[model samples]
Target: MSQSSQFKAMEDYFQSLLNEGAPEPSRAEPAPQVPVPAVVAKPTLEKPRQAELEQLLAKVPVTKPTVAAPVQAAKPAVPRTPAAPPPVVWQNIQTEREFQALFFSVAGITFGVPLTELGGIHQLGKLNTLFGKPAWFAGVMTQREQQLNVVDTGRWIMPEQDATPDYQYLIMLGDSAWGLACHELMGTEWLSRDQIKWRDKAGKRPWLAGMVKDKMCALLHVRELLTLLKQGVNIDGV
Candidate 1:
């Protein structure tokens, strides 16, 4: 064979192999499977059982039963009523005899009075002049539905000293009233009847009840003061 013809046949064979290898691949077919149906089972019913009957029969003839008599109940006892308590007796309460005393300051001199007879201490009120009276009997004033005869105690006790019109206070006795014009009301204190010490010899004046401690305290006789006021007597008398 000639070298060129052999080369041409080899080239033709190679071209046929390339054309067949370049072609598109075909898809594979799926396998077919047979379908199976689901199985269904039917329910079974059971029959009911029968119950047996029992019979009761006596071999001998039956007789009626005898009943016993009923019993009587016991009687209840009567209850007695309770007695009432005794009445309570109450005793009367007795009060102690209490006395109040006052301290008055006038011109540096100090004096005190038993407040038992003293009605009250108050500020100077409007004065009502009383004629035919001493200078010491300043005037009159109405207080608590009673006539209060105003007396300048400072001037009456110490005539040497003059009375300052601004200084004044009321001294109220049991059912009797008087004004003790003083420089100041120095408050009050509580004292017992035993606190008083009587003088060895009675004083010339009955108005002085007694003395207390070192103080020359004079218990202004309330009854005497009221009596003197009623009689329109000069209280300035010793």
Candidate 2:
């Protein structure tokens, strides 16, 4: 009806339309519905399988530090056997009671006598030849104020034996001297008492004691040998 009333009515109607266009107090749309999935439990392992895994771990070998052994030295070899010694040879000289017979070779014949009976062996020195004596009597020589008579035993023993001018030595038997012209002096050998095998004395001459071992060896009584020389019977020849 009037202008004011019309304006008021129009305002009222716009207000009512705005209020109707506005959503009514929105109930919060329930949050979009989300479903939570249930958790699935894992299966437990067997005791045997766990034990086998532990055994495999134990079986795995571990490395260790090593030590070296000491070395030994070689020994030298020894000799198995020893050498032997040589043998000994001895002389047959036994007793002092038995005399040693020294031999000399004269004109290829050997003659020996006991060294105990020998006075001495001397080198031929200055001698005096006596006249009117037997050819077997070599000469008379002077030595130490003693008159020495020499006899050539070889010539005396065998009348056919020749005289050797190179007589160099004079062998003195007791107080008498005899020329023993020998080629060489043989070595001495011991003659035991048992070695002298004596023969019958009754059949023997005064110059010989007895036969010794088949030969007529004079039992040289030095005095008697000299006596036979003085008599010129050629003691060696007799």
Candidate 3:
């Protein structure tokens, strides 16, 4: 069928029969559409929470840095020697009999006393000073129940020499109550008669037996020493 004839037929059918001749309505034209512009939305930005961030950081445990201590070196120990006991050698000095003599020093001067004649040796203890005594008379000290007179040996032996000496030991004379104050007590040694330069006669210094050649010190005559002490005379019995 022709396109225009088909439309005219559909239109003839829709026409009213009562209408003798109806005029064709004029076709209205459609309006054109205008294009809309594109819309771009801006990004939304949020601010940082100062209080919430601090709370999270505070919840975490904080660890402090550790420090090591410095090491130190140790020192070595030193050795010390103890003082020895006084020596005891028994036997009196005889003409043909061998003897042991104790050598001691006072104010740097050495003197030897026979072991037999030496009553006892004691460390210097507290002294009981007495007045009116000689300048050489140091003082008196007591041991056990006996009283002993301590002679300032240095002052007695060398009256002209003036000075004070620290006496360490008191050397007893025979069985007398007198002891010579000396500084250092050199141990005893064996000595023969010939080894000693014997005195054929009594000399000015009667307390001094003789000079010991090898020792180069005075050998004490305990008997005379006790006599001089008892007499309250000086070393030369002056």
Candidate 4:
């Protein structure tokens, strides 16, 4: 034995190094325990495309914004009054040279006067006032037997008679013997200097002298009021 075969080859290399460090022999059925997945925390969706664009803008149809009704101003129309101008008749009579006058009225205006300057009409007796005489005389009145003097043809042409004028008739002026008085005796009227409208001077009553066109009267000039009642002249001072 050569040392017992060299110790039997060193005990077969130490039993092959203890079979390569000894931990590789498991039977393969003990490897099934892998369950570790519990982390769930994903619930926060406020802008899911802005909540689907506000649910497609709440299905489309909302248009309310109209307030227009306040405009009222139209009311002003009423004005009418004018109607009166028609009374002046004497249509076209072509002149010749006629005469005869008289036509009277006084406070409501309308006067004529030439019956060749008259000299007789009488019947208006009692009127005695007479102090200094000239307020258009208006005093003495004995008529036909003469004393006449009277005058007052509306106080010798408007000396104020706001209604208190009765006057029945006296007239008679011719030779400055005066008398006159009168109110409403509208009697005679024949006219024609083409029915007068003379006035070249005497403007504001020097006894007028023109305008008789078919009875509108105002012709009076009785010879300039008989030379201003023979110059005792009051020229209408009142």
**Cα-based TM-score, every candidate:** 0.49, 0.48, 0.59, 0.25
Candidate 2, pairs of clashing residues = none
Model 1 lowest lDDT segment of ten: 48-57
Clashes of 4: 0
Q: Return the clash pairs for model 1, or none.
A: 100-115, 119-172
Please report the candidate that would top TM-score against the real structure: 3
Clashes of each: 2, 0, 0, 0
lDDT of 3 by residue, 1-238 (tens): 9999999988887766645577766587755777787786775444357667777899999999988787777677677787797763322335446888999999888999988888999999999989999888888998997899999988787777664568899999988899999999889999888788877566577677877889889998888778788888888676
- Candidate 4 Cα misplacement greater than 4 A, ranges: 1-71, 76-96, 101-112, 115-120, 128-169, 172-197, 200-202, 210-238
lDDT of 4 by residue, 125-226 (tens): 686677876766778877567676877766666555432367887777676567677776778867778769777665446656778877666776776666
lDDT of each: 0.63, 0.62, 0.82, 0.71
Candidate 3 stretches greater than 4 Å from native: 1-96
Cα lDDT of model 1 by residue, 1-238, tens digit: 8999999999999988888957565566755676676676665333322111111233345777978788878779678677787753322111135577787776666766775566677677877987788667778777666677777766766666666567766655555466666777778877666666643332354445566555556655555555555565544553
Could you tell me the lDDT of residue 74 within candidate 3?
68
lDDT per residue as tens, model 2, 100-184: 7766665666565667657777666665778888777777777788777777667866767676566666766754555444456
Model 4: weakest 10-residue lDDT segment is 87-96
Candidate 1 regions exceeding 4 Å error are 1-98, 142-147, 199-202, 214-216, 232-238
Ranking by lDDT: 3, 4, 1, 2
Give the distance in Å from residue 106's predicted Cα in candidate 1 to where it truly belongs: 3.5
lDDT of 3 at 147: 95
| Local distance difference test, candidate 4 | 0.71
For candidate 2, give the lDDT.
Answer: 0.62
